[model samples]
Structure formats: structure tokens, C-alpha cells
Target: MKILVLRFSSIGDIVLTTPVVRAIKQQVPGAEVHFATKPGYRSLLEANPYVDKAHYLNSSLRELVQELRVEQFDFIVDLHNNLRTSLIKLQLGVKSAAFDKLNWQKWLLVNLKINTLPQVHIVDRYLAAAAPLGVHNDGQGLDYFIPAEAEVSLTTLPAAFQQGYVAFAIGAQHATKRLPVERIIELCALLRQPVVLLGGPEDAANGQLVEAHFSNRDAEKSQSRILNACGQYSLNQSASLVRQAQFVISHDTGLMHIAAAFQKEIYSVWGNTVPAFGMYPYRTKYHILEVPGLECRPCSKIGYEKCPRGHFKCMRDIQFEPFFPAAPAAAAPASQNRVG
Candidate 1:
């Protein structure tokens, strides 16, 4: 069978679909699995072995559809169940199944503060899209591949981080999803270990702020050295850094899921979004930190440029010491590569 699995964009959401891809390939006899995603994420799937072919959405959806028509997939698995996928299923005219996004459940949770959503992680829900095809979760968790050539060499990082470091992903898609710069600086003040700040070019300034704050505060101390690596490397290179770290601390974002793929213990900080959405770290040792029992918590199903309530207490009032007791090891060895 020739199957086309669709999850169009985002680092973390696409990564979450890997289990469905693996199940389709392993369980379906003679299955040739193809994945469709945005072009920027080509790197994420190119290195993956289970996906036999990859189709990237181009400038025109019609053109992308035409390209897929040639492959004539036997079925469709829509993990990203949105309007775009709906249109694709309509155009392809194929027998297909899609994951239920539970939009109403999310709406009730976000707007009414009512708890109606399931506790299942999004990965398991994504897998449900393939149930008709007899695909089952192998319980191995998510998949991420870093080609050997793309690996970030430890020698290339600052000498201070050569021994060990905590990889902290400091950026999220929305401002409200991340801690304010002041809060981040406050947390780093207590870490007392080598720290590598991780993010894209957009986060470079904030990463610099964190690094500069420490650089001036403790000019002579090497006990806690901070390196601002935002915008310095590609996504896979950043994943390489995450793989090599002793553990990872991240705002709710893509790197957090990447850390889970590596099975690195993760400390996931929360803001307006809560863990009940089931996007938390999957099948890995993890902790969730958020300001609990606030009436204004989960103000949005997604996030906002600023807090809707103007107080931002969901993130501002969060406590760290209780979630993070002992500091991570000063020299914990890096994890060995499990994916090619």
C-alpha cells in the first residue's frame, strides 16, 4: 500500500506525527510511506528513514496537489486535521482518516475553564487517525534524526561548556508562552552550572540579555558561564546541542519535544497554556511547572502577544525552587546517538 501522511508545519507538531509514520511502515505490509510538510521542515523528515518519500507544500496548493496526484496514494492519514488537510482529502478523492482536533473540548477548557479534554497526549490521538489501517503504537516514543554531519561538535562550543551544560530553549511562538526576560535571568541566577541558551534568530536578543546579565554580574566567576547560541546554528545543530546536554529546561516549544525524543529529562515551563492540552513531554521523564489555581489561567487555547488579563500571573507568579530542588550535575555526560 502507498500511504501519504499529512502534517503540514511546525517543528514540534510534525515531530509528534513520527509514531504514526513508523506504525504505517512497520505494520502495513508492503507499505510505502510518504510524508507532506512545509518546505522549511524538509530537514526534519529527510533524515527520517520510515518516510519513503516526502512532499513539501509549495507556493501553490493546487500545484502541490497535482504533484501528489502522480503518486496516487492508497490512503491518507491527516494528523494535522485542519481546513487545508480537509481540502486535500477532498481534492484527492481518496478514502482517508483524520485525527480529531477536539476543537470544542479545547474551547471549553480555554474559554470556560471547564475540564473536558482527554488526558491522552497528542501523539496517541494522532495515532488514532491510522486505526482503520491496523497501525498500533510500538511504545518506543517519538523519532528525530540528526545526520552525523549535522552534529554540533562539543569542541566548537565555548570552553566553559566543554565539560557539561544545561540546554535551555528560551523562545516560544508567542510572548505569553514564555517567561519574561527578568524571570529567566532570575532563574539562571540560581542554576550555578554551565548554560547554553537555545533559540532561533528571533530569540538572539533575549539570549544575549541573559548572557550579558551574567557576564557583568559575576565577571570573575566561571562557576556559572552562559553562552548565547541563538541564531548561531541550524535546527538540527540545535537538536545536536539538546542531545548532548545533561538535561534540558525549556519553555513550551519545539526543543522541549526534541529533548523528549532524546529521552533527556525535561523541565517544561508553562505560561497561559496548561498541560491538560496533552502537548506536554511524551514518553520521557519530565516535569511541569506552572502557577496553579489561578482563575485566569489558560486564557487562550493558543497564546497571545501579551497576557489577556494584563496581570500575566500565569507565568509571573510561578515558583521555581519547588520544581527544581538540587541543581543538575556539573559534569553529566552527553547522551549517545540513538537516531541516524
Candidate 2:
């Protein structure tokens, strides 16, 4: 059977859908799974062995839909569930299921602070979308496959970062989701291990500020050595860094999910967005550092370019704790999610 799974245009959201792709391939006999994502996200899925073929929406949706119709997929799994995917299913006229995004519950929580959303992780919800085909969660958590050719060699990094380091993913799609640069620098000062800053080209400027602060001779005398790897590595290369890191400190962004894929210890910092949104690190050891009582938080279901109330207290007020290489605290282990 040939099944098509659609989750277009994102680093983290697409990463979260990997289990659905894996289950459809592994559990369904002779199943051929095709994944649909935006052209720019090739790094995320191209290396995935379970994905039989990838359909990139590099052109118009109409054009892409025409291309998919030729495949004659037996079923459709719409993990994205956006207007575009809705149209694709309509055009194809196939049996399908879509992941529940819980927009109303999200609105209720964001607007009225009501906790009506399900406690299930979003990964389990994505897995449930495939239950119609007898696909079940493997309890193995998320998957991130790095091509052998793309694996970053630690020897190429600064000598200080060669042994072990903490990967600080310093970027988020929205500013409200990221800690301010000053806070990042302050946290870097608290870290006793080597530091590697990770982000996209857009985050290079902010990464530079943190890099410059740590590179100073006086700061270097007291703090861990820092390497600003912001725009230097591709997504997979950065994922390689995350895979090899002693621990990870990230914003609510894609790399955090990627770290979860590798089962890395993640210190996920929260900003305007709250963990109740169900996008927290799945099936991995993670600690959430958010301001305890912020009435202005969960400001938007997504996030704003700046805090809507202009206080930005969710990020500014989070306590910056120095990380120790001891048994992690707060977040439970991946084994606790032994059976999803």
C-alpha cells in the first residue's frame, strides 16, 4: 500500500511527524510512505529511510496536487491540516485523517487561561492520526536522521569544544519565543562547560553578540570557552552538534525537537509561549525554565515579534541556573514514556 503523509513548511512541526511516517512503514505490510514538505526542508526528510519518496511543494499547490494525483496513494494522513492540505485531500478525493490542532482549546487557554487541552504530547496526537490504519505509537519518541556525509566532526571545532560542550540553540521563529541576547550571555557565563551557539542565518547577529561577549579576554578568564556556530552549519550539521553535545539549551524551536529525536538532555527555555501548548520536548529528559506566575504569558497561541504587553517578563524573569553535569532534575526521563 502507498500512503501519503503531509506536513509542509516547518523544521519542528515536520520533525514531530516522523513517528507517523515510521509506523506506516514498519507496521503496515509492504507499505510505501511518501512525505510532503516544502522544498527548503529537504535536510529534514531526505535522509529518512522510512520515507519512500518525498514530494516537495516547490511550485504551485495546484501543480503539486497534480503530481500527487499520479501516485494514486491508497490513503492520506494530513498532519499539517492547513487549508492547503485540505484542498489537496479534496482534489485527490481520498480517505484521510488529520491531526487535531485544538485551536479552540488553544484560544480558550490563551485568552481565558482555561486548561481544557488534552495532556497528551503533540507527537502522540500525530500518531493517533494514523490509528485508522492500525498504526500505533512505538514509544520510541521522535526521529532525526543525519546523513553520514553531513555529520559534523568535532575535531573541526575549537579545541575547547572538542571534548564536550553544551549546545545553545539561540534562535526561534519569533522573538517572543527567544530569550534576549543579554540573558543568553548571562547564561553562558553561568555554564561551566564548553559552549556552542546554534541558529540559522537570521540568528547570526544575535549569536554574534553572545559570541563577542564570551570571546573577550576578561570574560574568557572566568567563563567557559564559547564557539559561535550560528550560521556556520546547515540544519543536519547543527543536529549533529546537538547529537554529540553533553547537553542542550534551546528556545522553543526546531533544534529542541531535533535534540529530543536524539534523546539528548535538553534545558528548554520558555518565553511568551507556554509548555501547555503540547510542543515541549517529547520522550526525552528536559527542564522547562519559565516565569512561574505571568498573567501576560501564553500571549498568543504562536508568538509575537515582541511581547504584546511590552514587559517581556516571561523571558526576562526566568531564573538563570548554572548547569551541573549531574543527574538531571525537574523533567522526567524518556523511559517514563515507555509506552505511548
Question: Which predicted model would earn the best lDDT?
Answer: 1
The sequence of per-residue lDDT tens digits that candidate 1 reaches over residues 241-314 is 99999889898899999999999888789999988898998888777778878898788878999988799998
Kindly list the per-residue Cα lDDT of model 2 for residues 226-323, writing each as its tens digit.
88888999999999999999989899999999999999888888898888889999888777777867887788878889888888999999876533
* Ten residues in sequence with the least summed lDDT for candidate 2: 331-340
Report clashes for each candidate as comma-separated counts. Answer: 0, 0
Give all candidates' CA lDDT scores.
0.88, 0.87
RMSD per prediction, one decimal? 4.1, 3.0
Could you tell me every candidate's TM-score relative to the true structure?
Answer: 0.95, 0.94
In model 1, pairs of residues that clash are none
Indicate the worst ten consecutive residues by lDDT in candidate 1.
331-340
Q: How does candidate 2 score on lDDT?
A: 0.87
Candidate 2 off by > 4 Å? 217-224, 322-340
